[model samples]
Target: MILYTPLANTDIFPADNAVFTKRHCVSYQNKQFFVEETDKGDFQVLQLLSTDPQDFLRQEFNPGTIIKEH
Candidate 1:
C-alpha cells in the first residue's frame, strides 16, 4: 500500500507480503508509528508508537488521509 501524509510529506510503501495487523508498528527515522488499514483499502497512521523524545513531532492523519495511486 502507498500511504501518504501531507502534513509530514511522508510516503510509506509496504511490501507485497507485509502483514498489517493491529499490533503492527513502523519505525521511521528512529521513531515508531502505528498502522491501521481502513475498509477502503487505504491505511492510517494511527499514532506515534513511542512516547519518548524525538527529533520531530508526530502528526495525526485521521479521516482525510490520502492514498496515492502508482
Candidate 2:
C-alpha cells in the first residue's frame, strides 16, 4: 500500500464568500484553493489535490463538531 502526505499549511486554499473565514490565505505556484462547502456540507479540501488525508482532521466544540483540517 502507498501512503501519501498532505500539503497542509501551504498557500493553496483560497478565501471567498463561500468560505466562512477569509483571513490568512496565500498564493503559491499560481494556484488557489479553499475550504469549500459541498452538497455533503463543509469539507477542508485543497484546490486540486487527488491525495486524501491519511485520516480526517476534526474537532469538537460546544456548537457541535468542526473539522479543523482534513
Candidate 3:
C-alpha cells in the first residue's frame, strides 16, 4: 500500500501491543501529549499532538521533559 503523509513509519504501522503499554496519551493544559512512563514513576514527554505552532515552542511540552502525575 502507498501511504502519502509526513508521519513517521511507526505512527502509521504500530509495533507490538507491549510497546504501547509503556506509552500513554495525556491531556495537560488543554494540550494533548504522548508520554512514556519512566522508571521513576514519572511521565516523560514523547510527543506533542497539537495543531498550534506556538505549542511547539513551549518548553514544557518538549520531548524528554518529565512530568509527575497528580
Candidate 4:
C-alpha cells in the first residue's frame, strides 16, 4: 500500500544541546523517508537529512521492497 504524510513548515520539537532545526517530514515504514515543505522551508527541512553530525539522520533508499535501506 502507498501512504502519504502531511508536512508543515514549523518545528515539531524544541532545540537544545546544540544547533537545532524543525523539519517537516514523514517516513515510509521508518526506512525510506522524505520531507516536504514550501520553498522557504526547503533548506531547513530537506537539508536536515544530509547535514553535518549525521548520526541522527537517515535515508530512503527506494520506493519498494519491504522498506529496507539499500
Query: Each candidate: what lDDT?
Result: 0.49, 0.35, 0.90, 0.35
lDDT of 3 by residue, 8-67 (tens): 998878886777799999988888999999878899999999999999999988999998
Q: Which ten residues in a row have the lowest lDDT in candidate 4?
A: 60-69
Instruction: Show where candidate 4 strays beyond 4 Å.
Output: 1-22, 32-34, 39-70
Candidate 1 lDDT tens digits, 12-36:
4455344545334555456565666
Q: What TM-score goes with each of the models?
A: 0.34, 0.18, 0.72, 0.17
Candidate 3: the clashing residue pairs are none
lDDT over C-alpha atoms for residue 54 of model 1: 50
Give the count of colliding residue pairs in each prediction: 0, 3, 0, 1
Total backbone clashes of model 2?
A: 3
TM-score, ranked from best to worst = 3, 1, 2, 4
What TM-score would you give candidate 3 relative to the actual structure?
Answer: 0.72
Better of 1 and 3 by lDDT: 3
- Candidate whose TM-score is highest: 3
Q: Which number leads on lDDT? A: 3
Of the candidates numbered 1 and 3, which has the greater TM-score value? 3
In the order shown, what is each candidate's alpha-carbon RMSD? 14.5, 14.0, 2.7, 15.1
Cα deviation of 24, candidate 4, in Å: 1.3
Given candidate 1, what's the lDDT at residue 16?
37
